[model samples]
Target: MSPEFATRYNRWRYNLYAPVYDRVVAAFFAPRRRRAIELLAPAPDERLLLLGAGTGLDLDYLSGCRQLTAIDVSDGMLARLRRRADRLGLAVDVRVMDGQRLDFPDACFDAVILHLILAVIPDPVACLREVERVLKPGGRAVVFDKFLPDGGHAGWARVAANWLTRLIATDINRQLGVIVGHTTLHIEHEESAGMGGFFRIALLRK
Candidate 1:
């Protein structure tokens, strides 16, 4: 909600990075993404909300889901999502909306997934509020991302890596648990791992 947050995010993400988005993010984290998504273990009938879905790479991971709503800040990214969805005969309700200001009714989704999206936003806490608002009572969201590693992290080395990567991709150093603390969701489970010890997946309840 800060001044120009949506404009800045969309302009950079779409105009500056759309052409290379897939290659860069994929080259860096495809294998890791696959592993994380598999761990999510979504059921077929679940009403899924995918935040910052970016081009629907996660679509391939949703084998059994019946309904899916894909949201991204970039219209270009949503375009890619639509084309891919059309090619695959999958129908995802694509919305060109910021995660922090999702325009949906309460209790709209059975589950939500924020995959490497929080850190890219100006205020990840705002995005979490939107997630908590739309999710049904007792529903939960699963997240997969790389944050500044804490215990097993390489300390200064990891910090350097974060800054360097930010020039290209979003940094992997956000404490999503802390951001979601104000919401009713309880952090049910947390896991961490990666090539550089920089991945975290948290399951949360509303």
Candidate 2:
């Protein structure tokens, strides 16, 4: 699929999944999400950006940072996020924005949070480039996502499944190292976050 088509499809899919997103993903990813946030350790008053902040599940872990901006392509997701933020009294600036084309100025954010987004987005390289552009010098990005291990091969089953999975949710064969290599961001720390080391937490520096 083309980039435009993939973006539109992702938006439509996420909108349809928004209502049950928490029930479906939150519990399973809760541990990794917490670990990612812990690694971020945002200071008070620091400006932060959350890419693909679906349903604002990470909001509770980010309460310390007062300046929070979250962007997602799904209107339904952002709407749910807004309600959650309000109920929790968190001052988050939520916007319907594409990750590959960030609307913020260069060097604007002190930190960035990217969880469960790389595999789901169509253009991971472009998204990471945008992240590199918006993050301030010495800023860190906390990323948590499933990626194929270095030098490991995807089985025939996974390769075939990706054909269907990409139509709805995530691609299981994304290479984290290859994607990160496309930008200037360097990994400062890395750790296995979920089962079988498929999901990982990587602290990247700009």
Model 2 regions more than 4 Å off? none
Clashes of 2: 0
Q: What is the lDDT of residue 132 in candidate 1?
A: 92
- Lowest summed lDDT across 10 adjacent residues in model 1 is found at 146-155
TM-score between candidate 1 and the true structure: 0.85
Candidate maximizing lDDT: 2
Query: Each model's TM-score?
Result: 0.85, 0.98
lDDT of 2 by residue, 1-206 (tens): 88889999999999999999999988888877887888889998999999999999999787777999999999999999999899889999999999999999999999999999998999999999999999999999998998999678999998999898777778889988899999999999999986789888999999
Error of 2 at 119 (Å): 0.6
Give candidate 2's error at residue 124 in angstroms.
0.2
Candidate 2: pairs in clash: none
TM-score of 2: 0.98
